[model samples]
Target chain A: MGKHTVVPFGPQHPVLPEPIHLDLELDDEKVVRAIPSIGYIHRGLEKLVEKREFKEYVFIAERICGICAFGHGWGYCKSVEGLMNIEIPLRAKYLRTIWHELSRIHSHLLWLGLMADGMGFESLFMHSWRLREKVLDIFEKTTGGRVIFSACKIGGVRRDIEDSELHGIAEILRGMRDEVREITDIFFKEPTSVSRLKDVGILSKEAAVATCAVGPMVRASGIPLDYRVADTSGVYRELNFTPVTTDTCDCYGRCWVRVQEIFASLDMICQAIEKIPAGDIAVPVKGNPNGEYFARLEQPRGEAFYYVKGNNTTHLTRFRVRTPTNMNLPAMVEALKGCDYADVPMIVLTIDPCISCTER
Target chain B: MGYLSFAGTILGGLFKKPVTTQYPLKPAVLPEELRGRVLIDIQRCISCGMCMRKCPAGAIVVDRSAKSWSINRFACVQCATCVDNCPVKCLRMEPQYAAPGTVKQNETFVKQAAAQPAVAVTLVKGVTPTASAPATGTQAAAASAATAAKTAAAPQTTPPGDGAGHA
Candidate 1:
């Protein structure tokens, strides 16, 4: 056996978009064990609920992670609404689904770009991000903000997308499909790309279930668990969404699952726009919420958990978010073991860690 | 050998124009939903201070005495809560974003009425100017008692004339 050497990967690294430190125990060039230490970017966002009113806390929630901003805001509002027993209008639920699906597409595309960049495919990264800009343009034309769509409120949505605008969005997505498929086909079919990821970081179905992985991470491992498929909140069930899964349980499988899910998200958005019922976007939400409620949603990363406790006051007593990245950390550490040093970034990127969301 | 599959796309790109635009030289088209900056029409402002109160970032300051509204552009999050809550639709969100600057931009908009000559100000208590004598002690006491009784008897709805003082 070779002598072991320890190396600290990052509190800062080029491949990592957020700050996280990992200590890798290496025997020669293979990582025998990996230890992760977080909390570098913790901003105490959960504690801010004591100061900011519940209505305004949605803004803080949205700021949790730029990629999953809409999902965070919607999850927070859903928790508060559950606490207050407020049933939003049907149209608002449909609109929330449309925006949420759009956010999912953008986030997966962004991850695909970052993954390609991590694997030294700069041209693929550029193409992926270029296509992502069209989705951002759709967000701008509908919700006013590319990253933070301040549309979700406690009772319902803040604004409504007109039927004509919804059709315009569908046309844009349909037009972009061929380009997206062309770019992503390179990832799936290119021998070099497939070789780098095909068997790099294998997380078996048992290992994934044991680690309680969520999102594409678990789906790639052959478990058909998806928060959206089992969701009780929102109109995801009514829209007839299906979870994309594969049994390969490798880095490449994770990438494939995400790309397939992007197409699924596009179909869901088109379906939501088609079946959208016309009604008031929002009803007046009066009175302070008083109760404890736990809300969970399928974020682009995974299943995000939000718990809110209001004490009949404007300020919430406690607000907590269990981001998907946080839940997938154990799975990440498991996947990191027995991998070459060069594959570290690829394995980490497959998990799609949002350090800000986890630390916040 | 895997690179051969991408040859078609590479050749296609050779004929197509570059995707990126010369942003600095050519202005980009902005969407209507863009939340760029907050602007207020000073003429339509009622000095009610609702925008100041509702702002999550506390980036706005409304000084009724000065007849001025000011905002620190950098501090504004462009959430549009102020615009939605404004009693009159005077506040608007301009689609064009504020130009990036090294220095903080503080914009103070003065009401047109502020430039006019000083006139007799009306107080909610019906106080008026008297050159020779101030309000007599008896008259002040009577007015105070009447107001106190009216407040005690009524449910104390928001007074119409009281502006920033009550807030």
Candidate 2:
């Protein structure tokens, strides 16, 4: 029998991009249990809905998480639009989908970089971020901001990409595909990386379903649960969206899912640009929204749900966001059980926790 | 299965130029569409208060009575909501960011009234021209001159507090 010792990890750690604390109960060099405590970066953005007008809250919603800013803004607007019964233009829908996919590419690249850094592969991390810079350049050219894009509005989008610019962006993304393939190849084929990732932390399909995991976490465990296929929002259905999955249910499987999803996102963006029709980008929204509606969106991390309740006024009565990281925390705790103490950070990184989004 | 699989990437990187720029020595390459900071054309502004009302951060204050507009640059989120909502098209977004400052201060812009044309001074014996003949053109000119003088004398007072702070 081994004596158990409780160890506190993070709120501030080199591998963590945002603040989250975990109490790890370790028996010698192996973790037996993990207890997570959040709320260090809570900004109370949901309560701001009562003070700011429903139309103005879109900007606030976009600031919830810098990585998934566009998705959060789109999700909030979709909820309010559903509440008001305002149908956006077809062109607007296609533009939103394109921007969302671009964000997904950048986000997955960022995650790959972080995962590499967590695995002690510094050069791979740098290469991943270097490829991601091209996507940020595209965002700056189209949406006016590199991080927090204030493009999504209540009724439609604020800006439109000309056909020539859209084609140019598609060309750039096509060129980026080869560079990304080169960087990701090392992760899959390199002995060092594969040794660290394969079968390190295993979360079985039943346990994943029990903890109610979302996004790549569940997909890696052979469950095809993705909001892009389940929900009819945006133009994903027209693009023939399919959830990427694997049966390994380990850290390497999660990495493979994210890498495959990045390629899938690039293809979806190209398809959308080809099929996009020229029309009005935004329509005039009239009157206040008066009802409650929930909007589901497939963020780069996973499924995010936005709930908005309006009371026939300029301001909404309630606004809530159920971020994917919040849903995956229980699954993370479950996965931490019986893992080597040295593999704790790598196991946590596989979930791709966005504490800012969760706490907001 | 190779341990040295990443060596080729390292060798290729040694020949390529560095990706990062010398930021402080050379100015950053800013995109044309970058939302940096808010700029206002005081001449074209109608003092309609649309920017003050629509600013989610509450960083702008339009004093219609004094014909002045003030914005706390530190409190602004640079969302360009003011630029989009401006009815008179006076507000715009400049790509250059605001210079960093040690202390917070409000940037106030007061519209200057155009110069008044010369008016002939007529004298009356029985009634005072200023008091009795209020409807005359000369009276209107005199009243405008007085108001313009008052506006010229008004000090550029900084708004009391940035409302609600940055969002």
Candidate 3:
């Protein structure tokens, strides 16, 4: 009778935290084309760049995303340093790498928990979140905040890690990996999990690339475009970059890529810490920045984009951020094609969407 | 291999303790140097505006004339800028983390830090607190004399809040 039955997906849909909505056009219980609607949690973070001082903008930038505060701080610092042509100390660079990888592991752990819950795998969800608590405990003990860790500042990180802390990190990671691998193995082996995920919400490489899908989403489609491996910023040069992907391009594939990334992050962290150099944490940056610059870094979900322009004043002129979730929304819609109505939330959860980062 | 794996899984299940603590009863201790609770040693506070100027959260109000400082527990972020630059060393950062309310406007976490008691021992030349005071005072000053070095190394004293004492 009707051309299609349209269903509103989210903003308060149990799947995501930050608000994001999708109108699904369904034909006989099958999603044909999904239309994504965003911008619910936009706080005008970019606008603050014009009002706050350059050095202090790091604080605002760190709030761009809560789960990955270190990533935000590192990205903003990298951007400002790029404009000033200032080279951070080797020790600072290694510390940033360690922090970034640790954040990635936590991000993936959080996603795994959510994904498990999304597919009705409650035990796995509890297991992952519980394991993630250890990481947060480490964060609180090492850097301070459990969520928005205000650890990274303008030039370097706020604190230094001692040998005992590094040992603690490596030991915990080793133990956590075993539990994570067990859950992952069970996820792939269970028939119910397979029935829900294996072939659902597929996005081919062509659609993925054209839609500018990023992070594990693109990798799931068989595109090897990881910013860490392709990165020449020298911060990630010493650490190995092994891109992981599966050809299924389905929810399972995306989930698998993220799972594999946890292992990759562990390896990177272990290496970065061993090669750490000792020096002054923060370098002396005399004055404010005066120029226009855009910087990009890989977030746990995908590629996070940052843009800042200075008017030679205490405050910046214009600042804009295009988060990875925003870039992948169109592709997420495409991925939902041919997916069953019941699996919509699972498909969305697999993307690990942080709509706050997206809308910011 | 299957039997061995199952056995290992069973063993793992029995040995691992639950990661989370019993909430509301079993409280945890946060680490030192943590930017958790905002402290203000009111007596040592010099009414200096360094903290007020640097606070990104605008949570501190220094009323020099009133000889008083107040902080809005609801507005602080615990960023620790006040503690870092307190020239009189009055503001101290500690590991007291607890938000008592809801909404960004309702997160009440206020505390009062009294003025630090300074021991009035006689000042000695060429003698300093070992492993404490850096050479910044010596090398930086010896390199450039003639300027009064009276308050050269006094840590700035800032009073209460992470910066959000609105009243």
Task: Point to the candidate with the largest DockQ.
Answer: 2
Those runs of model 2 whose alpha carbons end farther than 4 Å from true positions after fitting are: B1-19, B116-167
- Evaluated against the true chain A, what TM-score does chain A of model 3 have? 0.96
Candidate 3 residue runs with Cα over 4 Å from true position: A1-3, A232-234, B1-20, B98-167
2 against 3, candidate with superior lDDT:
2
Worst 10-residue lDDT window for candidate 3 chain B reads B138-147
Second chain TM-score per prediction? Answer: 0.60, 0.60, 0.49
lDDT of 3 by residue, A171-233 (tens): 888888788798788778888988888888888888997999999999998998888876554
Q: Per-prediction interface RMSD?
A: 1.0, 0.6, 1.4
State residue B162's C-alpha deviation in candidate 1, in Å. Answer: 8.1
Model 1 docking category: medium
**TM-scores for candidates 1 onward, in order:** 0.88, 0.88, 0.84
DockQ of each: 0.55, 0.64, 0.36
TM-score of 3: 0.84
Task: Report how far off residue B52 is in candidate 1 (Å).
Answer: 2.1
